[model samples]
Target: MNNNKILDVAIVGYGPVGQTLAILLGRMGYNVAVYERWQALYPLPRAVFHDHEIRRVFRMMGLENELEKVSQPSACYQWFNADWKVLVEIDWSAESISDGPFGYLFNQPSLEAILDRQAKAIGNVQVHQGWEVLGLSQNDATCELNMRKVEGDGAGETRTVQAKYVIGADGANSIVRRECGIEWHDLGFDEDWLVVDLQPNAGVELDVPDIGQWCNPARPTTMVPGGPGYRRWEFMRLPHESVEDLQSTEKVWQLLSPWVTPETASLVRHAVYKFRSRIAEHWQQGRILLAGDAAHLMPPFMGQGMCSGIRDAWNLSWRLDLVLKGICSEELLNNYTTERKPQIQAVIEASMAMGKVVCVADPQAAAERDAKFLSGQVPPLPPFPGLEQGLVFKTAKAGVSGSLGIHGAIERNDKVERFDDAFGRGFFLLSIGEDPLQSLDEKLLGELNQLGVRSVRLSKDGAPGTCRDVSGKYHQFFEENQLQAVLVRPDFYLYGGVSTHSEIPALVQSLCDEVSLKREPCAQLSQAKVAVR
Candidate 1:
């Protein structure tokens, strides 16, 4: 309705990814507009899992309690052979760097509903449901989105909206991506599977493995939680089976009968999906960018599809904020692709590896795979990849840059809580047994202050301006790494760390350089002050 008013960001798509970007940007007091073709939530399950890192992001959004109520922590993910013998087990229940369970299971619709409410409640965000993005174009200054209303009283109405930036959080078949002429690089992993979501009847319990994969050559299968009050089963289609036949309700029941009878559970939804791996050749072009499924898609074997998209939102949010606020150059956005694409590609490859192990249809190959695992000859699962190549200090101590920053409980104001909750979250400069700011001169401190970097000191004595590390995790991390200070990015990844307090200034300066912070403005202000003096 307000075509003349330019927005800071225009988001195309109102799914979880779009909603997340809107909420993140809006919370920073940016003018954000979201356009979605659907008038209402899908109200069904799609993505059923998220990791603790995503949980940390939700906590930053102030949704920790709401998420806890609607989601359940995952159990070990076990893989079995044709005879139901355990081949490999992954502990998804273990604690992670985010100070929570490694993984969780929840209904996508419920999570989206929560995010939708949060996004709409923000005064600066406008959510236009049923408005389809027809096309988008961007120049040096701004991007314009052409949209048409497809629902409600103003059906078929067209309007154009302008914004400083445009994000395509649209799904795999993204119109915005197409409009930008972006192409997808297929990773060659493709398979057809029947996905069935079921809600067990109240007061009835079904005996089933919590979360597992049955690598049977006869009929490879997957069973996992479908959020709080549901269950999901996926059956890989054998080479001889047709997609149409596998999608029938009768066939779905047959595949599910081994776990639950129709009388004991109700079928909520059943469909055939082609799980594939794909990545956009480029995620950004001038003022237009892609996030979530629009940027990449991986097999659901590792349960990182939605998680990766949400990571894009989190990673892009801070960068966009800095650029919008004029604190950094637009070139900072290029890091979004460099930092995220490699991580996403790694995830796709990892997921494909898992899919290959479980998608075997040949009896002889399946037997060989089982033998390798059961004989204790197979290597363990590789650890998840971290930020490797973007916006991180390259010359810092080994194993510090690009790794996840440590978090632990701390005592503040006589109350013990998570470190982030106590110290606040932002670009953090943390030190052990000393004040990191003490090493910086007035000019460097002023620049860091202008960037809103929070300086915190962790100590055992609980000094006036320092937080007490109640959990000892901080002390252990500092002692083992022989580090006195570390600079953490907003997304909780280490930009770099210093072994001594004197190195703090260089570390801080590196961040300023990486973000391309314009010191000329600050220098001009300083000169003006001196001239007055």
Candidate 2:
């Protein structure tokens, strides 16, 4: 091992979250590496489901399309009364959501394989198999990591690696979380469950991949679909039942009972484990930090354990890009936990609510769970100001438009024209007239463009413009104070405006420049648009 080599980031695990984070940063031109304890893809059927955010993370790795190829088609999660009567079916489909992709049910190992391949192909990512990280320490500028090759019987030598930052993507029993000296504030109700993974004979249809959750307060089972014609069932163990003892063929058959027939199913795998809901006390401390199970581990009730971590990856990735690339201040990075903590806290609470409602055993508790399920009570989705659907960006007519650019609901099948001219995936500028922005000269505009300054103009809405997405409503909002266009960020935070083509560069700089300068948090820039742009 080259102990003295340095990387832009050092990831502590190579599961789904770690591998995806590595490939994401590596593709962004950052030097990255992984310390993985697993020498190879281990036992299958670990993680069975992932939510929409996972889809977004996979897309960042350029695998969203590929995933659909191998992903199983699943749509509904149905509640059941132990006797097999269906209660309520919650349908999840991503045909209209912006972030894209609803959710999927597939074996975790396969997903990891796909991400691992991408990590290995990247020249900027170096992954070490069977390397157990011993400990780490970091200042603001860099980090030092200690590790030993676990695969070797006596390879006990520790190597030191220099890294600008470290992510703890290990499992719940994370050494990184431990070394950080943080603890989880628990949500109660720890219980044991037995997971049975088996192959069904061709033409056998017992339980649909459409997860059937038995919330009868009687017995709750979460059924998930494995890729390519396979399914697994997770059932809570009755008090005093031992999955270790159930490892016997007869015992396994007993557990598989009710769901599979003796002749229709063949046992492929089974495991027993218990878990509780938890969140990391601290997501980041200094240059060393945490993500995924290292940060939060809720029960798999919502099937969001791994997906939540993936969300952390995407959130952290863009901020890391800004900071590492000299576009933002590190204090803005502090908002990482700020933005994500609330979201994860919600996940933990929701998962806990699920455990309490669905895992009912007592008659009274079961009745309450059943009453809640039957009453058709659905929790409200978290409110985010950025998520309201509509033509989000209105053209602040930088002293150009007759009215605030038109803002309205984008109709289905509406042609968005060309988004290439619009600012996107970053803060950009737009122009409506022929005027050169007043704030910047041609030379300055050229420099801003070199620094990734983006601007565009449409003499009219139908003409050449940056309407990158037409399915989405891109309303025209016109403002008199601004120039001919507007600039928006990836997160859709309003950054600045262009009063003239010349002013576009300075507007972009004003919104993003100070983060790279000396400061903790960047000053907020606000913008106003007309009724429609």
Candidate 3:
């Protein structure tokens, strides 16, 4: 460990979350050091799915082409009864506001390999594999990590690394979380399930099953397509079955007998996992913070476990960058846990609801559920919830305040690119028909500029320094929501919006107060009433 100078940020665990944070912070020109216990990439596939928001993050990282090579769009997810009757269906194939597929399935090992390569290519990123974090202590100024080279030539040797901040992306049993003394709260969900992976043989004529959940009283199971020809099956362990009993090759074959035979498909891997739902009481403690699995864990029912972790990485990186650059007060860090906790809780609740639907073992109850669906009456899927708290502005349409900022393609240099590329990074104030910079008073515009807000006027015709709204979704979105302008946070979340230009000052001031940004000379608000809805 190099202790000559205090580094900007030190990340524990070099998994996808850690690697993503490293790449992001490196791009922000921060010195990043990542320590992981694993000497090499875990060869097995774990998380195999991510949504379009994550795809946008990949685009920001300039790895969209590489990501496309190892991923394929997911089909609609359907649920069925024991007799193969449809209970419910979720259309995952719909185009997202981000102008991309809503969901994608990929090979995790391949994706991690690409992330590792890209992270290593960054000049400011240093990855230290086979290093174990034994202890951590932090003061107001810096955090010190005690680590040991647990493998190869320097085995058993100890060293210390100092950093301004440290992040724990080290999976479920995070040492950083433990050292911070954060308590883990179980969300009252625990189940044992056997997951099996398969690869069909060439020239096999059998049709592969579509992605779906089989909610049977006899044996609840799920089947989802992997990348390309790969497939996955998950079967719940009954009360009578022990972990030992399910681990037997014969029992595994008996479970898969209905789907494939040794002749048609080959077994890739099988493991019994105790799917659980747990979240930490808090995500931050002093200079040490938690992200990814260190902060929360959910059952794979909704396929948001890894996606949530990736979101955590993205959320934390931008906030850390702002704080490190002196653009915001350290108190801004408090909003991270305040914002992410509720969003993750909502995800957990949704996942648990899906779990309850799948884990039904009562014959009569399962029949009743099947009847409810077969009667041409099915519960509508819940809308995706936004952040319930944090740096959101209080206004007439508060619901959309904490929600994600929508994205669309814009014509740039005779080519189309996503809005982020054209608008540039950092806080963005985008207006539909008027120029926010020109309309905003100089006092407000100067303060906003000082806070690093980029003003862009979205127009119909392609013009230099203007987003063209190529898909027309931007104009439609504003028209539908009755919004004339929207302030987009750097993390791509809606900070606020206003229907009239007169409302800009109050909203910007509120945002500055939310982030604890101090203005040199505070401007007075207008007495005129402004409608933000």
Candidate 4:
């Protein structure tokens, strides 16, 4: 048995969530170790869609160009009845605060390949494939993982590794979550469905609705783009059919015959998936934490299954980074579940609501649903939830805290580009007409710098030390919200905002308190109303 050196972070799965965390932390120069039982990336397609928020995350990793080549923007999502009458339409092409298309469709394998290459390119990230984690134990100081090689030379060799924190991004059947004695809280949604992936042949363009759902009671189905060169269809398994019978090649062909044939398109893969809605009771226990599918699982109705997991990684990365740097205590991790669970729960409920609408198997119920939609009585889809609590500033006034911050084109150093590209990614103290740092005292300024908070002044006049808001988005945001200074977290969420620049120091001071930055109390300001939301 060999004992490996302690790592700053240990990831137990090599899926996109784990890979994302590795890349984010490794780029920050943290020593990250990733363990996976598989020797190579999964070749089959799984998740096929990601929203603009995820696009922003990938852009932060400098994968914008690479992702563009393999992805196609989603124009819209439509749901239709058996008669082909449109019941609902979601505009996925609408502009988002992330400054891009609302959603995108791409091949999961290609995306994983891109993330794999990026993760390996970072010298600080050590990816250990073919290593199966058999057991895990965590003390107050560190977590230890017991594992053995499952493939290649010295396959039977066992080793123990240590990490300050361990994250389980290992799929639904997660070993890390099990070891921590965490139980799942089932949200009462489970249904079996057959998923089929196809690649059309040359010059073959089958006639079908692009990204629409056929909500027919006889055979509820879903048709959408799988990626650049692929298409996917899903059929809800009727009660009369067995899962085994639905997955057969003959049945698959029959289900796909309406739109494609053996010559028009080639079958890539087909399987029956039991869409479930479940969330773990706890996401963290001691130094062991859960992320991605390990933390929550929802039906694929909204296509946020993978997106939600990536959000978990993004939320955890910064908190872990702060803890590893000793800038914050481990107690800061308590906010992990506090901030993410509610949003994920809301998503699960929404997806389940959609599933109920689409998975109707009765003739009368389907007719009623269609009539309600046709009558315009059905309500619109609920907006996606944001951070309503935990580590965010609360004010008596209606503030922009817990909302996603805006991003737009800005001109800096005679070059025009996206806000992130122009100023870089981190905690940003953005002021509209003046320098936000000027209000901060030396102590607060030093702490802000230590926290890697970047202060930027934006204006249309192009004054010295201020970037030009080329797109006028910054001006609009500040004006609409009646805010002069805004504090944005690394995840692009607004911590809080102030209507005046003098309150900037108070906002910064509140942040210092929230993040557990040890500093002496500065003189109080009358307008400073910083409390946790």
Clashes of each: 0, 34, 0, 0
- By lDDT: ranked, best first: 4, 1, 3, 2
Error of 4 at 219 (Å): 1.0
Our tally of clashes for model 2 stands at: 34
Residue 389 of model 1: what lDDT? 91
For all predicted structures, in order, the TM-scores are: 0.96, 0.78, 0.94, 0.95
User: What is the per-residue lDDT of model 4 for residues 1-533, given as tens digits with 9 covering 90 to 100?
Assistant: 85667899999999999999999999999999999999999999999999999999999889999999889999789999999999999999898878988999999999999999999999999999999989999888999999999987789999999998999999999999999999999999999999999999989987988899999999999999998989999999998989998968999999989999997998999989999999999899989999999999999989999999999999999998888888777777988998899989999999999999999999999999999999999999978888887888877136488888889898888898998887667788888775666677767776776677777788897777778889888889899989898889988988999999888878988887888764545444321221110
> In lDDT terms, how accurate is model 2?
0.64
RMSD of 2: 7.3
Q: Which stretch of 10 consecutive residues in model 3 shows the poorest summed lDDT?
A: 524-533
Q: Find the 10 residues in a row with the least total lDDT in model 2.
A: 524-533
Candidate 2 C-alpha lDDT tens digits along 3-57? 6777888999888888878888898899998988877767576787776545544
- Report the C-alpha displacement of residue 502, candidate 3, in angstroms: 1.5
Which consecutive 10 residues in model 4 have the weakest lDDT in total? 524-533
Residues 1-533 of candidate 1: C-alpha lDDT, one tens digit per residue: 54998899999989899999999999899999999888988888999999988998898889998998889999999999999999989999998877888999998989998999999999999999999987788788989888999998799899999999999998999999999899999999999999999999998887778999999999999999998889999999999989988978889998888889899999999989999999999999999999999999899999999999999999999999989998888999987899999999999999999999999999999999999999999899888888889899989888888888877788888899998786556788778765666667778776886777777778887887778889787888889899998888999999999998878889988898888786755642231221100
lDDT of 3 by residue, 226-262 (tens): 6767788899998887988889777878988887888
Model 1, residue 387: C-alpha shift (Å): 0.7
Best candidate, lDDT-wise?
A: 4
Per-candidate alpha-carbon RMSD to the true structure: 3.2, 7.3, 3.7, 3.6
Regions more than 4 Å wrong, model 1: 523-533
Give the poorly placed runs of model 2, Cα more than 4 Å off: 83-86, 99-101, 152-154, 207-209, 240-249, 375-461, 472-533
